[model samples]
Target: MNHWNSGTAAALLSAILMGGSAAVFTTMPAYAQETVKLELWSRQDPSGPLRAGNVVKAAERLNKELEAEGSPKRVEVAVRESPAKGFDDDALQLLKVFGIDQGPDMFIAAHEWVCAFQEDGFLLKLDDYIAKYPQHFGTIFPSLWSSAKCPDGTYAIPQDAEARMFFYNKKLLREAGYDDAFVDALPERALSGDLTMDELIDIAKQVVDKTKAKYGILHRPNKGPDYIMAFNAYGNDFVDPASGNLLLERDKLAAAFGWFERAVKEGVIPANNTAMEFDALRKEFYTGNAAFWMYGIWDLGSVAFPTYGLPKDEKGFFADWGWIAGPAAAKGGSPVSLTHPIVYAISASTKEPELAVRLLGHASAADLNTDHAVTTTHIGIKPEQLEDPRYAEAWPLAKATELLKITKFLPNNAQFGELNGIIYAAIQGIESGRLSADDAAEFVIDEASASLEDVVVK
Candidate 1:
């Protein structure tokens, strides 16, 4: 069952903010006397439990700290929940409609949307804030800050960054005759790219033949930035940023898609994968119906402790689950992964821009943010935060961190969403046998290149 339904971003926002106004006012009887109350907007994975409550708590904490410091006016945070679907486009449209005068005070968004937000003048330039508040700003990962900066200047501050990898069910592997020795050695082999893709396929085949597991892997079919890691591992990219042209690297892209298609054809992956939503695929993996799943670090928390309606505790079910870098496509190639940070931006229309910036800064602090990561099982962007004991207890986070060194950012372009749509259509076409791999590649490139022509590069 796909837990994630197609919901409009605006509708989700309304749902999250339901009774939020009353809650905010209840928390702050003197809120009107406060310098400013900022309305922060963000979309969370509906299936994930952490986002909404955490943001509220963070705001409460920030307000208390300010009050303790004898500041007469505390910044009150009003959060609006946004749904994950078409969220980036919705945020862009909101920025355009509201401009700087009456939009949100702050927003949580993906890194890929940074360029679009900056180009549209929907975000506040954060260079001044960062400079004045160097102590608070210095805790973030340098790479994360760089990723959030536009060519013209800095705009957003990164909130969370993620790494994607392959996770396997160790019990399933062992039950199929692969033991600890084999499992422990998988990571190094996978990283070296010497782990031939064929070997993986063979193992999946073996598992199905020996065990009762329905499928060996559960990968989703949606085309978006998420698929870039697999494509990049094979030394292929969808678009060329420098020339704003679609890359015509047919052989590599075809090899990647061909491998995926072959997995489905071989009964290693479900034939109905194209119709599966991410949440359903995850549930299948968590319930032991599947042996492997490809997903971001966000999956770590729930998978490590299987809580959704499972009769067994997560540890009991996931005790044998292990993580490895995604398999390399060739010998001597570094294992490739995609790195994208979830960034926070101030709305151009915010009534409390300064307060919103302060709240964002406080939340991104190394210690405080590390706590959030530990609780949510997210990877930390700050180097110092990784050393914290809280992060140390999160095993999945530590494993994900190991994969970060080899990660690459997704294609950052104004036309990224449209490009992803083209890529997804082509992938579906090839997988379903509606088009040849070569034809699909050509179609993706032609459509993407045309779309890129209008993308503002700055």
Candidate 2:
């Protein structure tokens, strides 16, 4: 519920003046030391709280530390205003701002776009500062560092990440004739590699036949990176190990599309899935009209239960819902959930880079980030963040933190956008029964070549 506004200074000064002795107020200069402004930009979240709330909290923390340390400089935060829109739309607007040489001091964005920003030289290389300030940068999970780096250098500090999984309605499955024990063992079956993709879909098929639910399984309505994990669960490697380029293995294409094909044919998935908005898909799962829903963990806590008017208590929210890391595509194959961070990247164009890093260091502290994590449905970025009492008390954050260890990541390539577009389009075609998996595979290959040109390695 914290917000950054233009009146923060006035409020701060009023609180200080009211609390202090009259003698101190008279002795202190009528105008205190100059305050350096830290401008930050993060996409406006749809619910719960602002994404930049912690950054403002961090600046407040840093100000206290600065005064205690006898430093003259004081830092205040300014959150740049932008249209309240989806992630990509806000990102494009930032890019347009950057075009006119007017980027913010720091910005928060999806790690997938880091590569594109680095290529454009829009990001500040943080190698020196990260080395000097080891406490802040040194402790990040090793896997996540890849997202902050390119062949040139490390450019950002990761904020937080979530485990993307498929959520199923336990009550609906029970009504659909699945015994309680079978329903309880679903995730274990998935983790131990006993559940295969076909069996997973078959379970949904049974639900459809026995229950009156409108759909058996549902996924994100639009094109993005989530389905890549499903394919990874099917034992498909999307990136070439040697070259680090995006790879499309034609052989596994059939199994990938086969899942959607079967879902549509069995009436488990609605034929008009792509036509639905995110809100409608969420309402479908919340209303118990769909047996399963797949999306990031953010929705489970931040958007679905509270904002959608479903339920808030853990029992009321999850009593009927269970989550799996999306069952493996085949028995003995690895089940996977995707994890990617939204990172804080400094603009290369900023005049006060050191001050920006200082602010970020304070902002990214465990206690400070806990403010954002507890309300936003995001898991802590560092292992130690799990120990924070606030993060520990939040049921959703506690349950999701452990799953971060088993999560997969998208390849760190700039062409990933082009690759995802082709694949998502092909998925739409295959799910609609308009393209066979083989045909979709070929179409992806052609589109990747044309769109990606020399970047894709087939």
Best by lDDT: 2
User: Which ten residues in a row are the worst by lDDT in model 1?
Assistant: 20-29
Q: RMSD of candidate 2 to the true fold?
A: 8.1
Candidate 2's residue-wise lDDT over 1-458, tens digit each?
A: 12335365445334433432211001122234866776787665644233577777777767777787777877877776454355565566566566556667898887767766777678899989988987776776666676677666788888877788888889889998888899889887877778877787778888888888888888887877777777777656666655556777776766687778878888888888988988898888888788888787778666776676756666775667778877777678777888878889899988788878987987778776777777777877777877888777777777767667667877666567768888889889977889887888888888887777454443
Global Cα lDDT for candidate 1: 0.67
Tally clashes: model 1: 6
Write model 1 residue lDDT over 281-333, tens digit each, in one string.
Answer: 88778777777777776665565445554323336534577667777776666
Q: What is the lDDT of candidate 2?
A: 0.74
Candidate 2: stretches off by over 4 Å: 1-38, 43-50, 64-78, 96-101, 131-134, 138-143, 235-245, 276-280, 302-311, 315-319, 349-352, 411-415
